[model samples]
Target: MPPNINNTTQLAQNSDKMAAPISPEETLARFEELSVLEAEFEDAELELIRKSTALNEPLWKKRAEIVAKIPHFWTLVLEQIPVELETFIQPTDFQLFANSLQTIEVSRFEIDDPKGSPRSFSIKFGFDDNEYFFNKELEKKFWYRKSKDWAGLVSEPVKIVWKKGKDLTEGLTDAAYDLAQAKKTLAKTSGGKSKAKAEASLPEYKTLASKIEDDTEGAPSFFTWFGFVSSYRWISAEESEEADKEEKTRLEKLKRGEKLDDDEDEDDEDDDADYQETEVFPQGDECATLLAEDVWPSALRYFKQAHEADDEELSEIDVDDMDQDDSDGEIDIRGLVSKGRTSSTSPPSKKQRKA
Candidate 1:
């Protein structure tokens, strides 16, 4: 203004100053604040789950007793599972569910544990002397855990102990169990060294890999879920706790504007690069979550849905038959009478006659 500068020029200069790039430090600080907020939200969610689980315990038990008396109740409920889970259930699996599946229950097994997560749960399946497996009750548990590079539900393969020639999974479960045992043995013998260094030497591992590759079936059996492991590498509870603590410490330092060492960052990258190679049931976690969250809590609704579907099918068939009869210029008077419909040939009602 002192030098007769144009007002438009001054305004444009001010806009340019306002549009200056954010410093990396400021950007990182903002990101850290958001990360902390996300963590708080997660903690809140877990607290709510814990509270709800307690409130629903007695109700779940009562519901289980009621459904147990209804023949094929679990089977019908399973049939109404989401398509993502339905795709994994082969024809053989359905047969097992229909014939022998007696009861299905989902429980938050670790809800009370201080270190454990309310999100951790188990799927328990009861069978009535099934021809498939030796276990009368099969329960698969999933632990909500965190590792350095990954986190979520992790489970050890539940051994099915199949009857001779009755394994619905076609030996996949057996092979998976063997491989897991072999790895455990190897880990103990090798004094905590990485199992991958000598995994190729293990016969159990090779056999399972070959079996998985040679499978010609369109989809693996739902029973194979008993052999499911973590989506990433399996981490023990102790290891998970250690990793969680370390992560919390790292985040604290990040929030305080402390720079992470270059070497530590490089090491973390290397750890992430070591991906787990074997995956018996990749969608097992999703299936387990669906069973726990949707199928378990809403069993009655799903059962009703199944019945509604059957009724709709029958109604459609009746409509189609009626159309065919009309097209043929014939009417089934008995059919109309059975459905409580008056035939055209019937005499007029008293009200109609009066009109």
Candidate 2:
């Protein structure tokens, strides 16, 4: 009876020894699960980087475009502005001071023929120490559109005298009708101004009058006659004042010896290069809308998570110890596993090892 009892106790001890808290298969499965998680993390991280780059490219381009174009618009104002206000200054004085216009380093423009009048060519406006510039062609189309638009915005119609026919009886008849229409419109309007003031507004009248005297055609068509109307108006004082203020600031900067940079002048290298700084017009609030501030941090977080997921162990461990092999010439899985255990059989001594 005592021997059977001892055998039963020994059998219970052996059963306890066989039971392991975590098996080799389970450890391998855990490693594989971690590997899958790491793979997913890596994919997510890569995707985040790609998204960040995609967004960054356009944002930079837009910012650069805006910086360049704003200054260029001001340059256009400088060039064609005299045509609108020619009455105020002498043509000879304007020609003499035309060279002075180049002194304002805010913009740099060149005519195709430097010696000739600047009727058509290209212009570049410099900003940010010449780090950025906007260029555009100054063709007839631009001039025509810009003139009409500017006239509409800045001037009120004072008079419109259509050029009459060149033939004797027909010319007198058309002149009479146009004069009557002008008087009627003038009478209906509330403003009471001198005829001289009204006449002074109509700069186009001079052109139409010259054309009519020179033209041999009898009676011009309505389409052709419409071009002869001497439309004119007083310039908007408020808009002029605003523009003058900016121009004054630029001039003062010039007086202070603030020169524009020319180191990155692509114009010197390539004549046909596109210098048109197409803008992304940014209003005060709209400027903030373009920022990629949120996405970059999210990308970094994803990258960090990917790196963290690849680590084999959750707890602190000596990397040097991990690289060293155990007596069996295998990485010690016990050290890699989490701290949890149950009784298990041990390996045999060196002398008792299998051949």
Query: What C-alpha lDDT values do all the predictions have?
Result: 0.71, 0.29
Q: Which candidate number has the best lDDT?
A: 1
Task: Kindly provide the TM-score of model 1 when superposed on the true structure, using C-alpha atoms.
Answer: 0.78
Please give, for residues 132-214, the per-residue lDDT of candidate 1 as tens digits. Answer: 88889999999998866567888888899899989888888888888888888887788554446576568987788778878
Q: Candidate 2's residue-wise lDDT over 1-355, tens digit each?
A: 0121111111212225666456544554444444345545645864664555456547645544553443222222222332223222233222222212221111111122222212211112122221111112111010101121132111111122223332222242234234435544654573543533443244333333444455554322211221122122222334344434543443454345454232232332222322111111112111111111222223234333423332323333332343343433223232322123222423222242356
Clash-forming residue pairs, model 2: none
Q: Report the number of clashing residue pairs per model.
A: 0, 0
| Candidate of highest TM-score | 1
Instruction: Tell me how far the alpha carbon of residue 338 in candidate 1 is from the true structure, in angstroms, after superposition.
Output: 22
Q: List where candidate 1 sits over 4 angstroms from the true fold.
A: 1-21, 254-259, 262-276, 314-355
**Model 2 residue 111 CA deviation in Å:** 43
How close is every model to the real structure, measured as TM-score?
A: 0.78, 0.15
